[model samples]
Target: MQQLNVIGLDQQGAEKLGKKLNKLLASYQIFYMNVRGFHWNIRGERFFELHVKFEETYNDLLLKIDEIAERILTLGQQPQHTYSNYLDNSSVEEAANIHDGRECVESILNSYQSVIRLQREILSAAAEIEDEGTASLMGDYITEQEKTAWMLTSYLK
Candidate 1:
Protein backbone atom coordinates (compact mmCIF):
# COMPACT_ATOMS: atom_id res chain seq x y z
CA MET A 1 0.00 0.00 0.00
CA GLN A 2 1.43 3.31 -1.06
CA GLN A 3 1.43 5.99 1.63
CA LEU A 4 -0.13 8.36 -0.96
CA ASN A 5 2.33 11.07 -0.05
CA VAL A 6 5.62 10.47 -1.75
CA ILE A 7 8.89 12.27 -1.09
CA GLY A 8 11.48 13.22 -3.69
CA LEU A 9 13.72 10.34 -2.58
CA ASP A 10 15.10 8.17 -5.29
CA GLN A 11 13.17 4.93 -5.70
CA GLN A 12 16.30 2.84 -5.43
CA GLY A 13 17.33 4.58 -2.24
CA ALA A 14 13.90 4.13 -0.73
CA GLU A 15 13.96 0.43 -1.57
CA LYS A 16 17.38 0.04 0.01
CA LEU A 17 16.23 1.73 3.18
CA GLY A 18 13.05 -0.29 3.25
CA LYS A 19 15.06 -3.50 3.09
CA LYS A 20 17.36 -2.47 5.93
CA LEU A 21 14.53 -1.19 8.10
CA ASN A 22 12.51 -4.34 7.62
CA LYS A 23 15.50 -6.45 8.55
CA LEU A 24 15.93 -4.48 11.74
CA LEU A 25 12.22 -4.71 12.43
CA ALA A 26 12.31 -8.49 12.24
CA SER A 27 15.23 -8.63 14.64
CA TYR A 28 13.46 -6.31 17.03
CA GLN A 29 10.29 -8.37 16.98
CA ILE A 30 12.18 -11.55 17.76
CA PHE A 31 14.09 -9.80 20.51
CA TYR A 32 10.92 -8.46 22.08
CA MET A 33 9.36 -11.92 21.99
CA ASN A 34 12.37 -13.29 23.79
CA VAL A 35 12.00 -10.61 26.41
CA ARG A 36 8.41 -11.60 26.94
CA GLY A 37 9.28 -15.27 27.03
CA PHE A 38 11.66 -14.75 29.90
CA HIS A 39 9.25 -12.41 31.51
CA TRP A 40 6.72 -15.22 31.77
CA ASN A 41 9.10 -18.02 32.73
CA ILE A 42 11.52 -15.99 34.81
CA ARG A 43 12.24 -17.37 38.25
CA GLY A 44 14.90 -16.75 40.85
CA GLU A 45 15.51 -14.28 43.65
CA ARG A 46 14.27 -11.27 41.72
CA PHE A 47 11.36 -13.11 40.17
CA PHE A 48 8.60 -10.66 40.98
CA GLU A 49 10.61 -7.55 40.22
CA LEU A 50 12.24 -8.88 37.07
CA HIS A 51 9.02 -10.39 35.82
CA VAL A 52 7.06 -7.16 36.17
CA LYS A 53 9.81 -5.00 34.79
CA PHE A 54 10.46 -7.31 31.87
CA GLU A 55 6.82 -7.30 30.84
CA GLU A 56 6.68 -3.53 30.96
CA THR A 57 9.84 -3.21 28.93
CA TYR A 58 8.60 -5.69 26.35
CA ASN A 59 5.33 -3.81 26.03
CA ASP A 60 7.18 -0.63 25.18
CA LEU A 61 9.32 -2.52 22.69
CA LEU A 62 6.18 -3.87 21.05
CA LEU A 63 4.87 -0.37 20.51
CA LYS A 64 8.13 0.72 19.00
CA ILE A 65 8.05 -2.25 16.65
CA ASP A 66 4.66 -1.24 15.37
CA GLU A 67 5.80 2.31 14.74
CA ILE A 68 8.95 1.19 12.98
CA ALA A 69 7.11 -1.32 10.80
CA GLU A 70 4.54 1.27 9.87
CA ARG A 71 7.26 3.62 8.77
CA ILE A 72 8.77 0.99 6.51
CA LEU A 73 5.40 0.21 4.93
CA THR A 74 4.71 3.91 4.59
CA LEU A 75 7.86 4.08 2.52
CA GLY A 76 6.16 1.88 -0.11
CA GLN A 77 7.34 -1.52 1.09
CA GLN A 78 5.94 -4.34 3.15
CA PRO A 79 7.55 -5.16 6.50
CA GLN A 80 8.87 -8.71 6.48
CA HIS A 81 7.97 -10.76 9.55
CA THR A 82 8.50 -14.35 8.49
CA TYR A 83 11.17 -16.13 10.50
CA SER A 84 12.96 -17.29 7.41
CA ASN A 85 12.96 -13.78 5.99
CA TYR A 86 14.33 -12.34 9.20
CA LEU A 87 16.87 -15.12 9.50
CA ASP A 88 18.15 -14.07 6.13
CA ASN A 89 18.26 -10.30 6.66
CA SER A 90 18.47 -9.40 10.33
CA SER A 91 21.92 -8.55 11.68
CA VAL A 92 20.80 -9.42 15.21
CA GLU A 93 20.55 -13.06 16.24
CA GLU A 94 17.54 -14.71 17.77
CA ALA A 95 17.79 -15.79 21.36
CA ALA A 96 18.10 -19.49 22.08
CA ASN A 97 17.01 -20.97 25.44
CA ILE A 98 20.57 -20.76 26.67
CA HIS A 99 20.37 -17.77 29.02
CA ASP A 100 19.23 -16.66 32.43
CA GLY A 101 18.41 -13.14 33.63
CA ARG A 102 21.99 -11.97 33.55
CA GLU A 103 22.52 -13.46 30.14
CA CYS A 104 19.18 -12.17 28.96
CA VAL A 105 20.14 -8.69 29.97
CA GLU A 106 23.38 -8.97 28.10
CA SER A 107 21.65 -10.37 25.01
CA ILE A 108 18.99 -7.67 24.97
CA LEU A 109 21.53 -4.94 25.52
CA ASN A 110 23.52 -6.15 22.55
CA SER A 111 20.31 -6.44 20.51
CA TYR A 112 19.28 -2.90 21.35
CA GLN A 113 22.73 -1.53 20.57
CA SER A 114 22.77 -3.39 17.28
CA VAL A 115 19.31 -2.10 16.43
CA ILE A 116 20.32 1.44 17.26
CA ARG A 117 23.30 1.15 14.99
CA LEU A 118 21.17 -0.20 12.14
CA GLN A 119 18.57 2.51 12.65
CA ARG A 120 21.26 5.16 12.56
CA GLU A 121 22.57 3.83 9.29
CA ILE A 122 19.06 3.72 7.84
CA LEU A 123 18.40 7.27 8.99
CA SER A 124 21.52 8.52 7.26
CA ALA A 125 20.65 6.76 4.05
CA ALA A 126 17.08 7.98 4.14
CA ALA A 127 18.13 11.56 4.78
CA GLU A 128 20.65 11.43 1.99
CA ILE A 129 17.87 10.33 -0.30
CA GLU A 130 15.57 13.09 0.98
CA ASP A 131 13.18 10.57 2.52
CA GLU A 132 12.02 12.63 5.47
CA GLY A 133 9.43 10.08 6.40
CA THR A 134 11.92 7.25 6.82
CA ALA A 135 14.47 9.52 8.43
CA SER A 136 11.93 10.60 11.02
CA LEU A 137 10.99 6.99 11.62
CA MET A 138 14.60 6.00 12.11
CA GLY A 139 15.06 8.89 14.52
CA ASP A 140 12.13 7.74 16.63
CA TYR A 141 13.28 4.10 16.68
CA ILE A 142 16.82 5.09 17.62
CA THR A 143 15.73 7.15 20.62
CA GLU A 144 13.33 4.49 21.83
CA GLN A 145 15.89 1.72 21.43
CA GLU A 146 18.45 3.71 23.37
CA LYS A 147 16.06 4.16 26.27
CA THR A 148 15.10 0.48 26.18
CA ALA A 149 18.73 -0.56 26.24
CA TRP A 150 19.28 1.62 29.28
CA MET A 151 16.35 0.12 31.15
CA LEU A 152 17.25 -3.46 30.26
CA THR A 153 20.86 -2.98 31.29
CA SER A 154 19.91 -1.32 34.56
CA TYR A 155 18.86 -4.72 35.85
CA LEU A 156 22.51 -5.72 35.95
CA LYS A 157 23.78 -2.50 37.50
Candidate 2:
Protein backbone atom coordinates (compact mmCIF):
# COMPACT_ATOMS: atom_id res chain seq x y z
CA MET A 1 0.00 0.00 0.00
CA GLN A 2 1.31 3.43 -0.90
CA GLN A 3 1.50 5.85 1.98
CA LEU A 4 0.56 9.48 1.59
CA ASN A 5 0.93 12.36 4.01
CA VAL A 6 -1.84 14.63 5.17
CA ILE A 7 -1.64 16.71 2.04
CA GLY A 8 -1.64 13.68 -0.30
CA LEU A 9 2.07 13.83 -1.05
CA ASP A 10 3.90 10.51 -1.14
CA GLN A 11 5.31 9.80 2.28
CA GLN A 12 8.85 9.37 1.06
CA GLY A 13 8.83 12.57 -0.92
CA ALA A 14 7.14 14.44 1.89
CA GLU A 15 9.79 13.20 4.28
CA LYS A 16 12.53 14.43 2.01
CA LEU A 17 10.82 17.78 1.67
CA GLY A 18 10.34 17.91 5.44
CA LYS A 19 14.03 17.35 6.05
CA LYS A 20 14.97 20.07 3.58
CA LEU A 21 12.42 22.39 5.10
CA ASN A 22 13.89 21.72 8.53
CA LYS A 23 17.29 22.71 7.24
CA LEU A 24 15.78 25.87 5.81
CA LEU A 25 14.08 26.52 9.12
CA ALA A 26 17.42 26.25 10.85
CA SER A 27 18.99 28.69 8.39
CA TYR A 28 16.10 31.07 8.87
CA GLN A 29 16.60 30.95 12.65
CA ILE A 30 20.25 31.90 12.35
CA PHE A 31 19.51 34.53 9.73
CA TYR A 32 16.76 35.96 11.90
CA MET A 33 19.13 36.40 14.82
CA ASN A 34 21.75 37.93 12.55
CA VAL A 35 19.24 40.45 11.28
CA ARG A 36 18.23 41.28 14.83
CA GLY A 37 21.86 41.89 15.63
CA PHE A 38 22.13 44.14 12.60
CA HIS A 39 19.08 46.05 13.76
CA TRP A 40 20.48 46.56 17.22
CA ASN A 41 24.16 47.04 16.44
CA ILE A 42 24.07 48.93 13.16
CA ARG A 43 26.15 52.14 13.13
CA GLY A 44 27.30 54.91 10.76
CA GLU A 45 25.48 57.26 8.38
CA ARG A 46 22.67 54.91 7.37
CA PHE A 47 21.82 53.90 10.90
CA PHE A 48 18.23 55.12 10.86
CA GLU A 49 17.38 53.51 7.53
CA LEU A 50 19.30 50.24 7.95
CA HIS A 51 18.14 49.81 11.53
CA VAL A 52 14.48 49.91 10.51
CA LYS A 53 15.14 47.72 7.51
CA PHE A 54 16.84 45.10 9.62
CA GLU A 55 13.92 45.09 12.00
CA GLU A 56 11.52 44.55 9.14
CA THR A 57 13.67 41.80 7.74
CA TYR A 58 13.86 39.96 11.03
CA ASN A 59 10.11 40.32 11.54
CA ASP A 60 9.49 38.76 8.16
CA LEU A 61 11.91 35.96 8.93
CA LEU A 62 10.09 35.28 12.18
CA LEU A 63 6.85 34.74 10.30
CA LYS A 64 8.52 32.47 7.75
CA ILE A 65 10.11 30.43 10.51
CA ASP A 66 6.69 29.71 11.96
CA GLU A 67 5.27 28.85 8.57
CA ILE A 68 8.14 26.51 7.83
CA ALA A 69 7.71 24.71 11.12
CA GLU A 70 4.01 24.31 10.49
CA ARG A 71 4.67 23.01 7.01
CA ILE A 72 6.99 20.39 8.45
CA LEU A 73 4.23 19.37 10.83
CA THR A 74 1.79 19.17 7.97
CA LEU A 75 4.25 16.87 6.25
CA GLY A 76 4.13 14.59 9.30
CA GLN A 77 7.57 15.42 10.57
CA GLN A 78 8.83 17.18 13.65
CA PRO A 79 10.39 20.63 13.22
CA GLN A 80 13.73 21.02 14.95
CA HIS A 81 13.44 23.77 17.54
CA THR A 82 16.61 23.87 19.62
CA TYR A 83 19.38 26.41 19.01
CA SER A 84 21.95 23.64 19.00
CA ASN A 85 20.05 21.80 16.32
CA TYR A 86 19.69 24.96 14.26
CA LEU A 87 23.37 25.77 14.58
CA ASP A 88 24.29 22.30 13.45
CA ASN A 89 21.87 22.18 10.53
CA SER A 90 21.95 25.72 9.23
CA SER A 91 24.24 26.77 6.39
CA VAL A 92 24.13 30.45 7.34
CA GLU A 93 26.71 31.33 9.96
CA GLU A 94 26.04 33.73 12.79
CA ALA A 95 27.00 37.35 12.15
CA ALA A 96 28.48 39.06 15.17
CA ASN A 97 29.09 42.71 16.00
CA ILE A 98 28.37 44.05 12.51
CA HIS A 99 28.30 47.79 13.16
CA ASP A 100 28.75 48.94 9.61
CA GLY A 101 25.66 49.15 7.43
CA ARG A 102 27.42 47.99 4.26
CA GLU A 103 28.90 44.98 5.97
CA CYS A 104 25.55 44.11 7.48
CA VAL A 105 23.74 44.39 4.19
CA GLU A 106 26.39 42.33 2.49
CA SER A 107 26.04 39.64 5.09
CA ILE A 108 22.28 39.74 4.56
CA LEU A 109 22.71 39.39 0.81
CA ASN A 110 25.07 36.46 1.20
CA SER A 111 22.70 34.74 3.58
CA TYR A 112 19.84 35.32 1.19
CA GLN A 113 21.84 33.67 -1.55
CA SER A 114 22.32 30.60 0.57
CA VAL A 115 18.64 30.48 1.47
CA ILE A 116 17.48 31.12 -2.06
CA ARG A 117 19.65 28.34 -3.38
CA LEU A 118 18.35 25.89 -0.83
CA GLN A 119 14.77 26.97 -1.47
CA ARG A 120 15.26 26.40 -5.16
CA GLU A 121 16.41 22.89 -4.45
CA ILE A 122 13.41 22.36 -2.24
CA LEU A 123 11.19 23.74 -4.97
CA SER A 124 12.57 21.13 -7.30
CA ALA A 125 11.98 18.36 -4.81
CA ALA A 126 8.43 19.54 -4.14
CA ALA A 127 7.74 19.73 -7.83
CA GLU A 128 8.92 16.17 -8.29
CA ILE A 129 6.35 15.05 -5.76
CA GLU A 130 3.60 17.35 -7.00
CA ASP A 131 3.58 19.12 -3.63
CA GLU A 132 2.02 22.39 -4.63
CA GLY A 133 1.87 23.71 -1.07
CA THR A 134 5.60 23.54 -0.48
CA ALA A 135 6.34 24.59 -4.03
CA SER A 136 4.19 27.70 -3.70
CA LEU A 137 5.81 28.60 -0.39
CA MET A 138 9.31 28.30 -1.80
CA GLY A 139 8.32 30.23 -4.91
CA ASP A 140 7.06 33.12 -2.81
CA TYR A 141 10.19 33.16 -0.69
CA ILE A 142 12.50 33.00 -3.67
CA THR A 143 10.79 35.89 -5.43
CA GLU A 144 10.88 38.12 -2.36
CA GLN A 145 14.44 37.25 -1.44
CA GLU A 146 15.67 37.76 -4.97
CA LYS A 147 14.22 41.27 -5.00
CA THR A 148 15.76 41.93 -1.59
CA ALA A 149 19.16 40.76 -2.81
CA TRP A 150 18.93 43.04 -5.82
CA MET A 151 18.06 46.01 -3.65
CA LEU A 152 20.85 45.25 -1.21
CA THR A 153 23.31 44.88 -4.05
CA SER A 154 22.21 48.26 -5.36
CA TYR A 155 22.69 49.74 -1.91
CA LEU A 156 26.27 48.52 -1.89
CA LYS A 157 27.04 49.91 -5.34
Candidate 3:
Protein backbone atom coordinates (compact mmCIF):
# COMPACT_ATOMS: atom_id res chain seq x y z
CA MET A 1 0.00 0.00 0.00
CA GLN A 2 1.20 3.52 -0.78
CA GLN A 3 1.91 5.68 2.22
CA LEU A 4 0.40 9.08 2.73
CA ASN A 5 1.44 12.10 4.75
CA VAL A 6 -0.47 13.48 7.72
CA ILE A 7 -2.41 15.73 5.40
CA GLY A 8 -3.39 12.74 3.26
CA LEU A 9 -0.98 13.60 0.47
CA ASP A 10 0.70 10.71 -1.26
CA GLN A 11 4.09 10.08 0.26
CA GLN A 12 5.93 10.22 -3.05
CA GLY A 13 4.28 13.44 -4.13
CA ALA A 14 4.74 15.00 -0.71
CA GLU A 15 8.39 14.00 -0.77
CA LYS A 16 8.89 15.76 -4.09
CA LEU A 17 7.11 18.83 -2.76
CA GLY A 18 9.27 18.74 0.34
CA LYS A 19 12.43 18.75 -1.75
CA LYS A 20 11.20 21.69 -3.75
CA LEU A 21 10.24 23.53 -0.57
CA ASN A 22 13.68 22.90 0.88
CA LYS A 23 15.25 24.51 -2.15
CA LEU A 24 12.94 27.46 -1.74
CA LEU A 25 13.78 27.64 1.94
CA ALA A 26 17.48 27.73 1.16
CA SER A 27 17.01 30.50 -1.36
CA TYR A 28 14.98 32.46 1.16
CA GLN A 29 17.71 32.05 3.76
CA ILE A 30 20.38 33.38 1.42
CA PHE A 31 18.16 36.21 0.34
CA TYR A 32 17.32 36.95 3.97
CA MET A 33 20.97 37.21 4.90
CA ASN A 34 21.70 39.39 1.90
CA VAL A 35 18.92 41.75 2.87
CA ARG A 36 20.17 41.79 6.42
CA GLY A 37 23.59 42.88 5.18
CA PHE A 38 21.89 45.48 3.06
CA HIS A 39 20.03 46.72 6.07
CA TRP A 40 23.18 46.94 8.11
CA ASN A 41 25.54 48.40 5.53
CA ILE A 42 23.39 50.57 3.31
CA ARG A 43 24.59 54.15 2.88
CA GLY A 44 23.90 57.22 0.73
CA GLU A 45 21.52 60.17 1.20
CA ARG A 46 18.69 57.65 1.21
CA PHE A 47 20.25 55.83 4.15
CA PHE A 48 17.43 56.48 6.57
CA GLU A 49 14.75 55.33 4.15
CA LEU A 50 16.55 52.32 2.68
CA HIS A 51 17.71 51.19 6.11
CA VAL A 52 14.16 50.98 7.40
CA LYS A 53 12.93 49.31 4.23
CA PHE A 54 15.65 46.71 4.30
CA GLU A 55 14.89 45.90 7.91
CA GLU A 56 11.24 45.41 7.05
CA THR A 57 12.12 43.21 4.10
CA TYR A 58 14.47 40.96 6.04
CA ASN A 59 11.97 40.60 8.86
CA ASP A 60 9.37 39.43 6.36
CA LEU A 61 11.86 37.02 4.79
CA LEU A 62 12.65 35.56 8.20
CA LEU A 63 8.98 34.83 8.76
CA LYS A 64 8.72 33.14 5.40
CA ILE A 65 11.78 31.04 6.14
CA ASP A 66 10.19 29.72 9.30
CA GLU A 67 6.94 29.02 7.49
CA ILE A 68 8.70 27.11 4.71
CA ALA A 69 10.69 25.08 7.18
CA GLU A 70 7.57 24.25 9.12
CA ARG A 71 5.78 23.24 5.95
CA ILE A 72 8.63 20.90 5.05
CA LEU A 73 8.37 19.33 8.49
CA THR A 74 4.65 19.01 8.05
CA LEU A 75 5.37 17.13 4.85
CA GLY A 76 7.54 14.72 6.84
CA GLN A 77 10.90 15.89 5.47
CA GLN A 78 13.78 17.76 6.96
CA PRO A 79 14.54 21.31 5.86
CA GLN A 80 18.00 22.46 4.75
CA HIS A 81 19.07 24.35 7.87
CA THR A 82 22.78 25.06 7.61
CA TYR A 83 24.37 27.92 5.69
CA SER A 84 26.33 25.33 3.71
CA ASN A 85 23.15 23.50 2.77
CA TYR A 86 21.52 26.79 1.83
CA LEU A 87 24.47 27.72 -0.37
CA ASP A 88 24.34 24.33 -2.01
CA ASN A 89 20.62 24.42 -2.79
CA SER A 90 19.85 28.09 -3.32
CA SER A 91 19.68 29.77 -6.71
CA VAL A 92 20.08 33.21 -5.12
CA GLU A 93 23.66 34.39 -4.73
CA GLU A 94 25.00 36.00 -1.59
CA ALA A 95 25.51 39.76 -1.65
CA ALA A 96 28.27 41.09 0.56
CA ASN A 97 29.39 44.52 1.69
CA ILE A 98 27.02 46.45 -0.55
CA HIS A 99 26.47 49.95 0.90
CA ASP A 100 24.88 51.96 -1.86
CA GLY A 101 21.10 52.22 -1.63
CA ARG A 102 20.52 51.84 -5.35
CA GLU A 103 22.80 48.82 -5.54
CA CYS A 104 21.09 47.19 -2.59
CA VAL A 105 17.65 47.75 -4.08
CA GLU A 106 18.82 46.37 -7.39
CA SER A 107 20.19 43.26 -5.74
CA ILE A 108 16.93 42.85 -3.85
CA LEU A 109 14.94 43.14 -7.08
CA ASN A 110 17.04 40.46 -8.70
CA SER A 111 16.51 38.14 -5.75
CA TYR A 112 12.78 38.79 -5.92
CA GLN A 113 12.76 37.83 -9.56
CA SER A 114 14.58 34.59 -8.87
CA VAL A 115 12.28 33.64 -6.00
CA ILE A 116 9.13 34.57 -7.88
CA ARG A 117 10.16 32.40 -10.80
CA LEU A 118 10.95 29.50 -8.52
CA GLN A 119 7.64 29.91 -6.69
CA ARG A 120 5.75 29.80 -9.97
CA GLU A 121 7.44 26.53 -10.81
CA ILE A 122 6.59 25.18 -7.39
CA LEU A 123 3.02 26.35 -7.82
CA SER A 124 2.73 24.25 -10.95
CA ALA A 125 4.14 21.21 -9.22
CA ALA A 126 1.82 21.61 -6.24
CA ALA A 127 -1.16 22.05 -8.50
CA GLU A 128 -0.30 18.88 -10.34
CA ILE A 129 -0.59 16.90 -7.14
CA GLU A 130 -3.61 18.82 -5.76
CA ASP A 131 -1.57 20.23 -2.92
CA GLU A 132 -3.67 23.29 -2.33
CA GLY A 133 -1.76 24.17 0.84
CA THR A 134 1.52 24.62 -0.95
CA ALA A 135 -0.12 26.07 -4.05
CA SER A 136 -1.81 28.74 -1.98
CA LEU A 137 1.42 29.57 -0.20
CA MET A 138 3.27 29.95 -3.50
CA GLY A 139 0.51 32.02 -4.98
CA ASP A 140 0.56 34.38 -2.02
CA TYR A 141 4.32 34.73 -2.14
CA ILE A 142 4.30 35.43 -5.86
CA THR A 143 1.65 38.10 -5.53
CA GLU A 144 3.34 39.79 -2.58
CA GLN A 145 6.80 39.65 -4.13
CA GLU A 146 5.57 40.99 -7.45
CA LYS A 147 4.20 44.03 -5.66
CA THR A 148 7.44 44.41 -3.71
CA ALA A 149 9.44 44.18 -6.94
CA TRP A 150 7.37 46.92 -8.50
CA MET A 151 7.90 49.15 -5.50
CA LEU A 152 11.63 48.52 -5.49
CA THR A 153 11.86 49.21 -9.20
CA SER A 154 10.17 52.53 -8.67
CA TYR A 155 12.63 53.24 -5.89
CA LEU A 156 15.44 52.76 -8.37
CA LYS A 157 13.90 55.14 -10.88
Best by lDDT: 2
- List the global CA lDDT of all models: 0.78, 0.95, 0.93
lDDT of 3 by residue, 11-111 (tens): 99989999999999999999999999999888889999889989999999999999999988988889988999999999899999899888999999999
In TM-score terms, candidate 1 sits at 0.85
Comparing candidate 1 with candidate 2, which one achieves the higher TM-score? 2
Off by over 4 Å in 1: 1-5, 151-154
Q: Candidate 2 regions off by >4 Å?
A: none
The Cα RMSD in angstroms, rounded to one decimal, for candidate 1 relative to the true structure is: 3.4
Question: Pick by TM-score: which candidate is best?
Answer: 2
| Residue 75 CA displacement from its true place in model 3, Å | 1.0
Can you tell me which runs of candidate 3 are displaced by over 4 Å? none
| Candidate order (TM-score) | 2, 3, 1
| Ten contiguous residues with the weakest lDDT in model 1 | 1-10
